[model samples]
Target: MSNSNSTPLMARVTLGRALRRLRDEVNHLTLADVAATLSCDISLISRIELGKRNCSQQHFTKLMDLYGVEESERDRLAELHAATREQRPPWWARYSEVITAEYERFLGFEAAASEVFEYQVGILPGLLQTERYARAVIGAGFASLGPDQIDALVEVREIRQRQRLWDSDQPLSCCYVLTEAALHFQVGGPQAHQEQLQFLLELQERQNVELKVIPYAKGEEGAQIAAFRIFRFADDDVPDVAFGESVAGSLTMDDPRDLRRLHRLFSNLSAAALDPDKSRDLITRIKNKED
Candidate 1:
């Protein structure tokens, strides 16, 4: 609802509608038929038809072939996918070389998200990261990337940060819950990490953004094991999604069951984490400790 101007959602909806229309025209395959072909569940197929799940590249390809779609239509769908991935880097930074192919895909989806909710148990999400911090994290994580690749990746990352300008028909709204340990973890040395925390404090004041903290003392309840981000599209038709990452790659889930699980986790996290004012205070405390 916030992104009344965003075209990505509309594009997604248009694709879903087209997919459904094509299916209907061909004696209408049951959910089972699509699921069997995609190696997913019937419910997932239903969600995809309803525009709740993002269409994967492979799925798009298969569907086009199956429906004998016209070249023009295929091209339009492809354009939508590419447009959804486009981003403008920050004026001061560049893309990162350490970024893997999977993360890049996730970043593309993030760029077009109408709203994002993140639960971070370790480090800050990339959107809230500063150039220095992001560089340090990327460089340390992947020592193999050549400087050229790293530079290119950093530029891409900076461009992705322009999600701030997200002003689609459904503007982006983001909520983040950061763990206390992430504050004192001392990533990129004291100064860079401190600045990152400070940046988070400033970012909290922006419209449509909310930052909360899960203090160390909160114990088990505050210790949500992994980090995940949920992206919700603006169009009424598209389904919401949750993305999870591991050391090597990440996975995206849009199944109704999976989405429901993530939604519940977010609700619990929001309740357990500190409110905005308190979260800001905690970050300030961490920054002052550095001083």
Candidate 2:
């Protein structure tokens, strides 16, 4: 499988999806069939379909021949070929500066997405974090991190949050589900936890936002999983993507089967969480304890 979290992977998926749509219009030519025709491994076909591998002009020519794509459609596929260069960012690109290469790709995808659905079991999602809260969280996780590194990480988090509401014609919509443990994590001690919890409440009031909490009693349901986000696009042009962190790195899933499983997981998790008002009340009760 390709490194799914890479921006190039996303571009590849966009290209593959366009090709797959063209293939579907022609007939039910399965990927396996295409691989057999190309005399390649099934894994290679899967990677091509998922945009995990870059396709060359020769590959494009082969696809046009196999799909019986028209001259105009051929032009469009060529456009995808053109995008190979377009997808590479400039030498001065800063969108990925402070983060790992894989995470930088994840950030690029999140920034470009139209909507994001996330669940955080251990701590607050970076998008909803305040500078102090973010720094504290980062420091806690990396005791060896210098103040300068923490500042840069916080800067990235802040930039990502600002982009969420970036006055674009297409602003990102966010739906966040957080666990009670997140509210009490105390990254910057009790005061910072209170402020962060308050920020969550305020975000819940936004038109493009919805926030919920899985109370402490929810136990395993609340704390069993690591945080993850699902990015959904308005363009039928692109497929929905799910990004989850691993010991190796973050993983992005574009395959319909994989996405379906993740979607189901999120749905069940959300269903088990408290509703917004109740979640807010749960947070308020926690805050009152600190008073």
Candidate 3:
């Protein structure tokens, strides 16, 4: 992603994980026992724990009752359950006039996620883009958009950055791993590129941000995968979500296998990337270079 605001990176609550967390707190109630008490199928409970399906209201209420959850807590859980299963289009769906369905779905999860980790292989990821760089990137990619449409898109990106940094009630924590080549492939003019690097330097000062760079090294050269992001939620109710995109479309998954692969790749990327301080130094050098 070249813009500073690509996909939203917040966790969408998962009823299954939340329910499983609660059930496990019931002092060793067996799975069969819960099914028997709730008069539901045991396999259904397993699916719920895996976040494979949504639970019905009747069953959800019964589960809450079985867990002896507080009335107030039950009210909140009920609301969240309803939201997760909302039949209405997600907030981003309105942007379907401008964006694809895959991108729209990504926004839903990104908006609600608490923590986001990204490994960028091409240009800088959207979260770190400056306005000028963002404009340059947008202008190049979608030459067809009218000035008004482009302006609207840029405005959305700015709002996205603000929300992640501080505008939202809960600020998003971001860890970004960028390829060293991204710095060399400048988007905006020299001055704007320099300014973007300076902005990155400033952003690195924030406690919630971690920026690392993967240099062109021998053994790790082929290890870098396509850019992907992992979003984690504040509560266990939502399973961690992972997303990646290609020329065709986007791929998002919360399956255990998918998550495991992302986690391992992220871990490896962290190891391969330069530490924050070194990454900053590299950026400074690139910025200072005569363009």
Candidate 4:
């Protein structure tokens, strides 16, 4: 089951999409039609369908009645509506001082994801990063923060790894496509870098984790793309979301068009990357060179 505390937004999105589908495909109704039926402004209906606003209990029941929704489907949507209205604080709520709201939302998605597809150009993904490597990366990126803040951020990364990768009953299935340059970047000096690569090797032994390296020979296949991850959930109602990291902040998108483009880009990168065994060999060779 998806963790409700970590996935309320996901539920909201699912409910919104379902409402929109019912309005369009089933009833063939327009926003104006829904608005008129509910006796509310069209913008209210639009925002509700877009997941930007919550549907009130009265409005929700009225919409269900307006659409002539069947009992079973209405019950399911009601559960999703309840989930969206849940007020439980996420596990990362304590770290609110250190992380942005956008990042907190990403964490929520990550915590609820069953599988993750990631592509990195210059560094290891957080779930695969060693503590020291994480500290170094966080410290550099958040250079203005004090040591305590940096340590707290590092703790956040460690907690994320533990909850999603190590401690979960069903560990998150992960496929990572990384550029060869990622292995060579040496984020936390030679010792920490070496440890990070060795850790990657060990992680490859796990059934849930798969790592592939895009050799330098592959050139710029993934270079043009910023680091990004595609998160897939177990629930079909909650659509897959793509997250991109940038200097400014993180961006999350669930638009089908954007998802299709990202999917195509990831497919191309994966096809151009080295296979698992060879990718492991390349990592080992690089680690040896670090000695």
| Clashes per model (N, Cα, C within 3 A) | 32, 0, 13, 0
Q: Predicted candidate 2: what Cα RMSD to the true structure?
A: 4.3
Q: lDDT, candidate 4, residue 70?
A: 96
Q: Model 4 over residues 1-291: C-alpha lDDT tens digits?
A: 355324677777778989999999999999999898888999998878767688899999998998999999999889888988988877888989998978887887898889999999888999999999999999999899999999989999999999988899978999999999889998889999899989999999999999999998978675756899999988776788889988887888888999999889889999999999999999999999878
Stronger candidate by TM-score (1 vs 3): 3
Please report how far candidate 2 places residue 182 from its true position, in Å.
0.9
Error of 4 at 81 (Å): 1.2
The runs of at least 3 residues in candidate 1 whose Cα sits more than 4 Å from the true structure, single-residue gaps closed, are 1-14, 17-28, 31-101, 165-171
Q: Select the stronger candidate by lDDT from 3 and 4.
A: 4
lDDT of 1 at 14: 51
The C-alpha lDDT values of all candidates are: 0.73, 0.74, 0.75, 0.88
- Cα RMSD of all models vs. native, in order, equals 6.7, 4.3, 6.2, 1.9
TM-score quality measure for candidate 4: 0.93
- Backbone clash total for model 4 is 0
Candidates sorted by TM-score, best first: 4, 2, 3, 1
Cα-lDDT of candidate 4:
0.88
| Candidate 3 error regions (>4 Å) | 1-13, 16-77, 84-96, 218-223
| Candidate 2, 173-271: lDDT as tens digits | 888888887777777987887888788778777778878888878777766556778998765677888888655657877668988887887887788
Model 1 lDDT tens row, 22-57: 788664777678778878888866666655567778
Model 2 clashing residue pairs (backbone): none
Q: Which candidate is the best by TM-score?
A: 4
